[model samples]
Target: MPFIPTLTLKDRLPRPFKIRWLRELMDLVDELYFEYGIVHQDIAGRNLFISDTTGSILLCDFAFSAQIGTVRHGQSVYLGEIPRCNDVKGTMFFLYYLITRDPQYSRYLLSDVDENTIMDRPKWVKHAGVELDYDVDTFYNELMAWVRKRRDSPKLAHYTLAPRHFEIPDPPEDGMEGWYLGRSHTMREMEAGRTTLSWERPPASKWDKSRKLLATGKYADERPPVRLMHVPDPKKGFPQMGMTNAALRGQDKRKQTQDVVGTEDEAEASKRRREEADE
Candidate 1:
């Protein structure tokens, strides 16, 4: 897939981001969850990118994406008996981290860090270097509002069902039961105590003077001993460079045949000359 050049949010570590960018990221995360029913379990500053051209924020790294209420590994829980880790909660923490630049709470596991704890806080204290287009409170309010709206929804929001379901097929049975060490032995051959040739690994490439020179970048200054002439193969049906359609059609049958024979002979001679030079 084609992608615009971008820098990760973490890459801008010491540099503060704008409030608008955070809001844009929030909208993108909301869309991923509510609209697409995808939970990007692994949401972090490293996964988010800022476009180099537009300076817009983009949430990425969907390797840990899962359906709303599906069960993953033991580390996380979005739904079921103990619903702990989720995108909404993750977004809240991520936004808090962006504003405050305090990674104290985020150091803990997802299930251990509670979003409500951050939400109940009186105010978010911005770091000395942290700068924003708007007041820290403004960004906080926007984030809180989104969190409230998400929390109001059903816990197990299985609204969107998969369009199609597919069962993982079993592995195909292998036909070469007696094939071992790159050698195939049929049932009859094995019963008759027949032996198969063992395959040897290819020898490592040896560095010749020319190869060493090329590897060390010394070959760039050297020119070829002989200048090569590009010989066009007529079998590929390439049009003659200077021949017009009218000129070609105007040629007599005998002359056209002679031209073809001349081209073939010249090609053969060139091949022989190349072989002799190589020898």
Candidate 2:
């Protein structure tokens, strides 16, 4: 899918079918890594696409793809194509940051940096007491090493300098990530009545209870039926900007206000403000 899609990845992640899709997805990546010596360094949600029919999945956006060093005899040689590594910067860094939760890749710090602003986070590896080349191979190798650490860890907290255990994906099964170890999804379903959904206790009707007086010329009536409000597909018929006309209009008004108040206009407004300030 495009970097930005109408449906946010967060919305798709909860559905049972989506979970299966995710498992296949990681497997697909692993397959690509081993078979093709290709590591889809950019493994974020935006890089994924879910087919509406059959709930099929796809991995796209090869703008950052590279045929890195292969896994010989089932080894994790994450060193990507060494020759053209310098060209890659954002994609691998993103994966490393997510898998490790390293603060260097924290959204708070790395969000604003651009190609012109700064180079890759070689410092990130350096800070960790590892010497790394300034290429995609180095980036991939370093990141994989970090991932292995978390894959074998107790808690998945990223380290600043040293490698720690990481949260590893359980070995793929029939190309799926089987039931999670935790009850997070099950608990969420219970809270939302998605599991073993059954009507627990019956509610008393108005006729079953003594009628009470009301202010309007109204009489006690049965409680309204519970109507389920299904959330619309996040990407479903998304508007050009995922916005309503009223919201856009409000933004337009705000821009007008900002233009009237912002720095660039101050010079012109200064004359009028000075006239008013004097008066």
RMSD of each: 18.1, 28.8
Cα lDDT of model 1 by residue, 1-279, tens digit: 447576676666525567777778778766666666666776777778777767787777665666666554333454531346677777777777877767685365667777767875564888787777788778888878877887786554552542332232332434543332322346557767887543342333642445434433344556758978776444333344444466446664444444554466665665666566556
| lDDT at position 165, candidate 2 | 18
The local lDDT score (0 to 100) that residue 164 gets in candidate 2 is 28
| Model 2, span 152-186: residue lDDT tens | 54421122112321222343335333422334545
C-alpha lDDT score of every prediction, in listed order? 0.63, 0.43
**What does candidate 1 score on TM?**
0.51
How well does candidate 1 score on lDDT at residue 195? 72
**Candidate 2, residue 45: how far the Cα is off, in Å:** 1.1
Model 1 lDDT, residue 108, Cα: 57
